[model samples]
Target: MKENIIALHQKNIAKGAEHLFLDKGFNLTSISDISETSGYSRRTIYKYFESKEEILYYLIIEGLDHLVQSIGDAIDSEQNFLKRYEAICACMLFYYENYAISAQSVNRFQSNAPLNMTTSVERIFALGVKINEYLSIWIEQGKEEGILKESLDVMPTVYILSTNLNALFELVTTKGTYLFASLHMTKEQFLSYGYTMNLNSLLKEPTK
Candidate 1:
Protein backbone atom coordinates (compact mmCIF):
# COMPACT_ATOMS: atom_id res chain seq x y z
CA MET A 1 0.00 0.00 0.00
CA LYS A 2 1.14 3.55 -0.60
CA GLU A 3 0.39 4.37 3.02
CA ASN A 4 2.49 1.50 4.28
CA ILE A 5 5.40 2.44 2.07
CA ILE A 6 5.20 6.04 3.21
CA ALA A 7 5.19 4.91 6.84
CA LEU A 8 8.29 2.80 6.30
CA HIS A 9 10.10 5.62 4.59
CA GLN A 10 9.16 7.99 7.36
CA LYS A 11 10.53 5.60 9.98
CA ASN A 12 13.82 5.19 8.17
CA ILE A 13 14.17 8.93 7.75
CA ALA A 14 13.52 9.51 11.41
CA LYS A 15 16.14 6.97 12.42
CA GLY A 16 18.71 8.38 10.04
CA ALA A 17 18.01 11.92 11.11
CA GLU A 18 18.36 11.07 14.78
CA HIS A 19 21.70 9.41 14.18
CA LEU A 20 23.04 12.28 12.12
CA PHE A 21 21.71 14.94 14.45
CA LEU A 22 23.47 13.38 17.39
CA ASP A 23 26.69 12.68 15.53
CA LYS A 24 26.90 15.85 13.41
CA GLY A 25 24.44 18.25 15.02
CA PHE A 26 21.81 20.34 13.22
CA ASN A 27 23.85 22.79 11.12
CA LEU A 28 26.17 20.12 9.77
CA THR A 29 23.45 17.79 8.53
CA SER A 30 22.07 18.19 5.02
CA ILE A 31 19.12 16.86 3.02
CA SER A 32 21.43 14.82 0.84
CA ASP A 33 23.02 13.35 3.92
CA ILE A 34 19.63 12.30 5.23
CA SER A 35 18.73 10.82 1.88
CA GLU A 36 21.91 8.78 1.75
CA THR A 37 21.69 7.61 5.32
CA SER A 38 17.99 6.80 5.15
CA GLY A 39 18.14 5.21 1.72
CA TYR A 40 15.49 7.67 0.61
CA SER A 41 15.83 9.97 -2.35
CA ARG A 42 16.22 13.71 -2.00
CA ARG A 43 12.73 14.10 -3.47
CA THR A 44 11.30 11.77 -0.87
CA ILE A 45 13.06 13.68 1.91
CA TYR A 46 11.57 16.92 0.70
CA LYS A 47 8.17 15.29 0.49
CA TYR A 48 8.36 14.56 4.19
CA PHE A 49 10.20 17.61 5.51
CA GLU A 50 10.52 21.05 3.98
CA SER A 51 13.93 21.63 5.54
CA LYS A 52 16.39 20.59 8.22
CA GLU A 53 14.73 23.02 10.59
CA GLU A 54 11.49 21.08 10.38
CA ILE A 55 13.37 17.89 11.04
CA LEU A 56 14.98 19.50 14.07
CA TYR A 57 11.59 20.55 15.35
CA TYR A 58 10.27 17.00 15.19
CA LEU A 59 13.36 15.75 16.97
CA ILE A 60 13.01 18.33 19.70
CA ILE A 61 9.39 17.42 20.32
CA GLU A 62 10.15 13.73 20.32
CA GLY A 63 13.13 14.15 22.65
CA LEU A 64 11.19 16.29 25.12
CA ASP A 65 8.34 13.79 25.24
CA HIS A 66 10.84 11.05 26.00
CA LEU A 67 12.51 13.12 28.69
CA VAL A 68 9.22 13.95 30.39
CA GLN A 69 8.13 10.32 30.29
CA SER A 70 11.44 9.14 31.71
CA ILE A 71 11.17 11.54 34.62
CA GLY A 72 7.54 10.60 35.22
CA ASP A 73 8.36 6.91 35.27
CA ALA A 74 11.29 7.40 37.62
CA ILE A 75 9.17 9.08 40.29
CA ASP A 76 6.00 7.00 40.04
CA SER A 77 6.81 4.91 43.09
CA GLU A 78 8.41 7.52 45.34
CA GLN A 79 6.17 9.34 47.84
CA ASN A 80 8.64 11.51 49.70
CA PHE A 81 9.32 14.93 48.19
CA LEU A 82 13.07 14.57 48.48
CA LYS A 83 12.98 11.06 47.08
CA ARG A 84 10.79 12.18 44.19
CA TYR A 85 13.19 15.01 43.46
CA GLU A 86 16.07 12.55 43.45
CA ALA A 87 14.12 10.37 41.07
CA ILE A 88 13.78 13.32 38.69
CA CYS A 89 17.52 13.95 38.88
CA ALA A 90 18.16 10.27 38.26
CA CYS A 91 16.04 10.35 35.12
CA MET A 92 17.87 13.41 33.78
CA LEU A 93 21.26 11.83 34.45
CA PHE A 94 20.22 8.61 32.81
CA TYR A 95 19.23 10.49 29.66
CA TYR A 96 22.50 12.43 29.62
CA GLU A 97 24.62 9.35 30.17
CA ASN A 98 22.92 7.07 27.70
CA TYR A 99 21.79 9.59 25.13
CA ALA A 100 24.40 12.29 25.32
CA ILE A 101 24.39 13.07 21.62
CA SER A 102 20.62 13.29 21.47
CA ALA A 103 20.57 15.36 24.62
CA GLN A 104 23.19 17.75 23.28
CA SER A 105 21.37 18.02 19.98
CA VAL A 106 18.23 18.97 21.86
CA ASN A 107 20.06 21.68 23.79
CA ARG A 108 21.46 23.05 20.55
CA PHE A 109 18.06 23.06 18.91
CA GLN A 110 16.55 25.05 21.76
CA SER A 111 19.33 27.60 21.69
CA ASN A 112 19.84 28.02 17.94
CA ALA A 113 16.67 27.36 16.00
CA PRO A 114 15.17 30.40 14.21
CA LEU A 115 11.81 29.28 12.88
CA ASN A 116 9.17 29.43 15.60
CA MET A 117 11.91 30.47 18.01
CA THR A 118 9.67 32.79 19.99
CA THR A 119 6.92 30.21 20.11
CA SER A 120 9.35 27.54 21.23
CA VAL A 121 10.67 29.85 23.92
CA GLU A 122 7.16 30.53 25.11
CA ARG A 123 6.40 26.81 25.25
CA ILE A 124 9.45 26.21 27.41
CA PHE A 125 8.50 29.08 29.68
CA ALA A 126 5.03 27.61 30.09
CA LEU A 127 6.55 24.24 30.89
CA GLY A 128 8.69 25.87 33.56
CA VAL A 129 5.64 27.44 35.10
CA LYS A 130 3.83 24.12 35.17
CA ILE A 131 6.85 22.46 36.75
CA ASN A 132 6.96 25.18 39.38
CA GLU A 133 3.28 24.60 40.10
CA TYR A 134 3.94 20.92 40.70
CA LEU A 135 6.88 21.77 42.92
CA SER A 136 4.65 24.05 44.92
CA ILE A 137 2.16 21.27 45.49
CA TRP A 138 4.92 18.92 46.55
CA ILE A 139 6.44 21.46 48.95
CA GLU A 140 3.07 22.31 50.40
CA GLN A 141 2.55 18.64 51.14
CA GLY A 142 5.95 18.54 52.81
CA LYS A 143 5.06 21.53 54.98
CA GLU A 144 1.82 19.92 56.05
CA GLU A 145 3.78 16.86 57.14
CA GLY A 146 6.10 19.05 59.18
CA ILE A 147 9.06 18.20 56.96
CA LEU A 148 9.81 21.29 54.84
CA LYS A 149 10.34 24.89 55.92
CA GLU A 150 7.01 26.41 56.91
CA SER A 151 7.70 29.89 55.57
CA LEU A 152 8.76 28.78 52.08
CA ASP A 153 6.63 30.21 49.24
CA VAL A 154 5.79 26.95 47.57
CA MET A 155 5.77 28.17 43.94
CA PRO A 156 8.70 30.58 44.20
CA THR A 157 10.90 28.12 46.07
CA VAL A 158 10.09 25.43 43.58
CA TYR A 159 11.02 27.70 40.67
CA ILE A 160 14.29 28.69 42.32
CA LEU A 161 15.26 25.12 43.15
CA SER A 162 14.34 23.83 39.71
CA THR A 163 16.30 26.61 38.02
CA ASN A 164 19.31 25.87 40.20
CA LEU A 165 19.23 22.16 39.37
CA ASN A 166 19.02 22.85 35.63
CA ALA A 167 21.93 25.31 35.75
CA LEU A 168 24.07 22.94 37.78
CA PHE A 169 23.46 20.06 35.38
CA GLU A 170 24.22 22.27 32.39
CA LEU A 171 27.53 23.24 33.97
CA VAL A 172 28.45 19.68 34.91
CA THR A 173 27.64 18.28 31.49
CA THR A 174 29.45 21.01 29.55
CA LYS A 175 32.62 21.58 31.57
CA GLY A 176 32.91 19.18 34.47
CA THR A 177 32.69 15.77 32.79
CA TYR A 178 36.47 15.24 32.70
CA LEU A 179 37.46 16.80 36.00
CA PHE A 180 37.57 13.41 37.70
CA ALA A 181 34.49 11.28 37.10
CA SER A 182 33.62 11.73 40.75
CA LEU A 183 33.18 15.46 40.23
CA HIS A 184 30.05 14.74 38.17
CA MET A 185 30.59 16.94 35.24
CA THR A 186 28.38 14.14 33.84
CA LYS A 187 24.69 13.34 34.40
CA GLU A 188 25.34 11.15 37.41
CA GLN A 189 27.30 13.86 39.10
CA PHE A 190 24.49 16.31 38.52
CA LEU A 191 21.98 13.89 40.00
CA SER A 192 24.19 13.34 43.05
CA TYR A 193 24.61 17.04 43.45
CA GLY A 194 20.85 17.49 43.19
CA TYR A 195 20.20 15.03 45.96
CA THR A 196 22.76 16.70 48.18
CA MET A 197 21.44 20.15 47.54
CA ASN A 198 17.80 19.13 47.89
CA LEU A 199 18.56 17.53 51.21
CA ASN A 200 20.37 20.63 52.36
CA SER A 201 17.86 23.16 51.06
CA LEU A 202 14.46 21.45 51.07
CA LEU A 203 14.74 18.53 53.45
CA LYS A 204 16.51 20.24 56.32
CA GLU A 205 14.27 21.48 59.17
CA PRO A 206 14.54 24.96 60.63
CA THR A 207 15.81 25.04 64.20
CA LYS A 208 13.56 26.58 66.84
Candidate 2:
Protein backbone atom coordinates (compact mmCIF):
# COMPACT_ATOMS: atom_id res chain seq x y z
CA MET A 1 0.00 0.00 0.00
CA LYS A 2 1.08 3.53 -0.67
CA GLU A 3 2.10 5.86 2.17
CA ASN A 4 -0.17 8.78 2.93
CA ILE A 5 0.70 12.21 1.56
CA ILE A 6 1.73 13.50 4.99
CA ALA A 7 4.14 10.62 5.70
CA LEU A 8 5.69 10.90 2.26
CA HIS A 9 6.24 14.62 2.63
CA GLN A 10 7.74 14.17 6.11
CA LYS A 11 10.12 11.55 4.71
CA ASN A 12 11.21 13.84 1.89
CA ILE A 13 11.81 16.70 4.29
CA ALA A 14 13.77 14.41 6.61
CA LYS A 15 15.92 13.16 3.74
CA GLY A 16 16.66 16.75 2.79
CA ALA A 17 17.46 17.61 6.41
CA GLU A 18 19.95 14.72 6.47
CA HIS A 19 21.79 16.25 3.55
CA LEU A 20 22.03 19.62 5.31
CA PHE A 21 23.28 17.94 8.47
CA LEU A 22 25.96 16.12 6.49
CA ASP A 23 27.19 19.31 4.85
CA LYS A 24 27.14 21.17 8.16
CA GLY A 25 26.86 19.54 11.54
CA PHE A 26 23.37 19.26 12.99
CA ASN A 27 23.86 22.02 15.58
CA LEU A 28 25.03 24.41 12.88
CA THR A 29 22.36 23.54 10.30
CA SER A 30 19.30 25.77 10.23
CA ILE A 31 15.83 25.65 8.67
CA SER A 32 17.10 27.85 5.88
CA ASP A 33 19.92 25.37 5.31
CA ILE A 34 17.40 22.54 4.89
CA SER A 35 15.31 24.69 2.65
CA GLU A 36 18.41 25.29 0.57
CA THR A 37 19.27 21.58 0.40
CA SER A 38 15.71 20.28 -0.11
CA GLY A 39 14.61 23.04 -2.46
CA TYR A 40 11.51 23.01 -0.32
CA SER A 41 10.66 26.42 0.98
CA ARG A 42 10.88 27.13 4.69
CA ARG A 43 7.09 27.21 4.73
CA THR A 44 6.96 23.68 3.29
CA ILE A 45 9.41 22.37 5.89
CA TYR A 46 7.38 23.89 8.70
CA LYS A 47 4.30 22.20 7.33
CA TYR A 48 5.93 18.81 8.12
CA PHE A 49 8.19 19.71 11.04
CA GLU A 50 7.46 22.45 13.59
CA SER A 51 11.15 23.03 14.33
CA LYS A 52 14.62 21.62 13.90
CA GLU A 53 14.10 19.58 17.04
CA GLU A 54 11.21 17.72 15.40
CA ILE A 55 13.36 17.09 12.35
CA LEU A 56 16.13 15.67 14.53
CA TYR A 57 13.64 13.39 16.25
CA TYR A 58 12.36 12.22 12.88
CA LEU A 59 15.89 11.35 11.81
CA ILE A 60 16.40 9.46 15.06
CA ILE A 61 13.30 7.42 14.30
CA GLU A 62 14.58 6.68 10.80
CA GLY A 63 17.97 5.63 12.20
CA LEU A 64 16.37 3.25 14.67
CA ASP A 65 14.15 1.81 11.97
CA HIS A 66 17.19 1.11 9.83
CA LEU A 67 19.01 -0.51 12.74
CA VAL A 68 16.17 -2.83 13.69
CA GLN A 69 15.76 -3.98 10.09
CA SER A 70 19.51 -4.54 9.79
CA ILE A 71 19.49 -6.63 12.95
CA GLY A 72 16.55 -8.64 11.71
CA ASP A 73 18.25 -9.30 8.40
CA ALA A 74 21.44 -10.34 10.18
CA ILE A 75 19.61 -12.72 12.48
CA ASP A 76 17.71 -14.28 9.59
CA SER A 77 20.86 -14.84 7.55
CA GLU A 78 22.97 -16.53 10.21
CA GLN A 79 22.30 -20.16 11.14
CA ASN A 80 24.79 -20.52 13.96
CA PHE A 81 23.65 -18.76 17.10
CA LEU A 82 27.20 -17.57 17.91
CA LYS A 83 27.67 -16.33 14.38
CA ARG A 84 24.36 -14.53 14.64
CA TYR A 85 25.83 -12.42 17.41
CA GLU A 86 28.65 -11.42 15.10
CA ALA A 87 26.12 -10.59 12.39
CA ILE A 88 24.28 -8.35 14.83
CA CYS A 89 27.60 -6.64 15.61
CA ALA A 90 28.19 -6.13 11.90
CA CYS A 91 24.70 -4.70 11.55
CA MET A 92 25.47 -2.17 14.28
CA LEU A 93 28.68 -1.20 12.50
CA PHE A 94 26.81 -0.82 9.23
CA TYR A 95 24.25 1.49 10.82
CA TYR A 96 26.91 3.90 12.08
CA GLU A 97 29.04 3.66 8.98
CA ASN A 98 26.08 4.30 6.72
CA TYR A 99 24.52 7.06 8.83
CA ALA A 100 27.45 8.71 10.59
CA ILE A 101 26.19 12.09 9.47
CA SER A 102 23.23 11.77 11.85
CA ALA A 103 25.11 11.01 15.07
CA GLN A 104 25.34 14.66 16.06
CA SER A 105 21.61 14.96 15.50
CA VAL A 106 20.81 12.07 17.83
CA ASN A 107 23.43 12.82 20.49
CA ARG A 108 22.85 16.56 20.63
CA PHE A 109 19.11 16.34 20.53
CA GLN A 110 19.12 13.92 23.44
CA SER A 111 21.53 16.17 25.31
CA ASN A 112 20.24 19.71 24.70
CA ALA A 113 16.53 19.13 24.30
CA PRO A 114 15.86 16.16 26.49
CA LEU A 115 12.38 17.40 27.33
CA ASN A 116 11.32 17.31 23.69
CA MET A 117 11.08 13.50 23.85
CA THR A 118 7.47 13.79 24.86
CA THR A 119 4.59 11.32 24.55
CA SER A 120 4.06 12.34 20.95
CA VAL A 121 7.60 11.41 19.98
CA GLU A 122 7.36 8.22 21.98
CA ARG A 123 4.20 7.25 20.14
CA ILE A 124 5.88 8.01 16.86
CA PHE A 125 8.95 5.90 17.65
CA ALA A 126 7.21 3.13 19.55
CA LEU A 127 7.73 0.71 16.66
CA GLY A 128 11.38 1.72 16.37
CA VAL A 129 11.89 0.23 19.83
CA LYS A 130 12.25 -3.11 18.00
CA ILE A 131 16.02 -2.74 18.40
CA ASN A 132 15.62 -4.07 21.90
CA GLU A 133 13.22 -6.76 20.75
CA TYR A 134 15.70 -8.09 18.19
CA LEU A 135 18.50 -8.01 20.74
CA SER A 136 16.35 -9.81 23.25
CA ILE A 137 15.46 -12.51 20.74
CA TRP A 138 19.12 -13.06 19.93
CA ILE A 139 20.14 -13.22 23.56
CA GLU A 140 17.33 -15.58 24.44
CA GLN A 141 18.10 -17.82 21.50
CA GLY A 142 21.80 -17.82 22.32
CA LYS A 143 21.12 -18.80 25.91
CA GLU A 144 18.92 -21.68 24.80
CA GLU A 145 21.55 -22.80 22.31
CA GLY A 146 24.25 -22.72 25.00
CA ILE A 147 26.30 -20.22 23.02
CA LEU A 148 25.75 -17.37 25.45
CA LYS A 149 26.02 -17.68 29.20
CA GLU A 150 22.76 -18.89 30.63
CA SER A 151 23.18 -16.57 33.54
CA LEU A 152 23.41 -13.50 31.34
CA ASP A 153 21.18 -10.75 32.68
CA VAL A 154 19.74 -9.85 29.27
CA MET A 155 18.48 -6.35 30.07
CA PRO A 156 21.52 -4.74 31.74
CA THR A 157 23.84 -6.54 29.36
CA VAL A 158 21.99 -5.47 26.23
CA TYR A 159 21.61 -1.99 27.69
CA ILE A 160 25.40 -1.62 27.92
CA LEU A 161 25.84 -3.00 24.44
CA SER A 162 23.17 -0.70 23.01
CA THR A 163 24.31 2.45 24.81
CA ASN A 164 27.97 2.10 23.84
CA LEU A 165 27.38 1.55 20.10
CA ASN A 166 27.38 5.25 19.15
CA ALA A 167 30.55 6.21 21.03
CA LEU A 168 32.36 3.11 19.83
CA PHE A 169 31.44 3.72 16.22
CA GLU A 170 32.33 7.40 16.50
CA LEU A 171 35.83 6.36 17.59
CA VAL A 172 36.23 3.93 14.72
CA THR A 173 34.67 6.08 12.01
CA THR A 174 36.39 9.27 13.13
CA LYS A 175 39.90 8.03 13.94
CA GLY A 176 40.23 4.41 14.97
CA THR A 177 40.15 3.18 11.38
CA TYR A 178 43.11 5.44 10.63
CA LEU A 179 44.86 4.03 13.67
CA PHE A 180 44.42 0.54 12.23
CA ALA A 181 45.26 1.67 8.70
CA SER A 182 48.61 3.00 9.88
CA LEU A 183 49.30 -0.45 11.31
CA HIS A 184 48.60 -1.93 7.83
CA MET A 185 45.27 -3.32 9.01
CA THR A 186 42.14 -2.56 7.05
CA LYS A 187 38.94 -1.27 8.65
CA GLU A 188 37.52 -4.76 8.19
CA GLN A 189 40.40 -6.18 10.21
CA PHE A 190 39.90 -3.59 12.93
CA LEU A 191 36.17 -4.29 13.04
CA SER A 192 36.78 -8.05 13.10
CA TYR A 193 39.22 -7.66 15.97
CA GLY A 194 36.69 -5.59 17.87
CA TYR A 195 34.05 -8.26 17.25
CA THR A 196 36.45 -10.89 18.58
CA MET A 197 36.98 -8.80 21.68
CA ASN A 198 33.22 -8.56 22.15
CA LEU A 199 32.82 -12.33 21.76
CA ASN A 200 35.54 -12.97 24.30
CA SER A 201 33.40 -11.01 26.75
CA LEU A 202 29.94 -12.19 25.74
CA LEU A 203 30.20 -15.68 24.31
CA LYS A 204 30.39 -18.95 26.20
CA GLU A 205 32.89 -21.75 25.60
CA PRO A 206 31.78 -24.26 22.98
CA THR A 207 30.27 -27.07 25.02
CA LYS A 208 31.40 -30.56 23.96
Candidate 1, overall lDDT?
Answer: 0.65
- Tell me the TM-score of each prediction against the true structure: 0.68, 0.82
- Candidate 2, residues 91-154, lDDT tens digits: the string is 8877777765544544443345556566547744464456777788888887888878888998
User: lDDT per model, in order?
Assistant: 0.65, 0.73
Top model by lDDT, which number? 2
Clashes of each: 1, 0
Error of 1 at 128 (Å): 6.2
Indicate the TM-score of model 2: 0.82
lDDT of 1 by residue, 1-208 (tens): 9999876766678778878877887678898889899898999888977677666655555555566666555445556766776676766566656655445555443355464655544554454444445556667777887888777777678667755765666676676756537663655555575568655776556322
lDDT of 2: 0.73
Model 2 pairs in collision? none
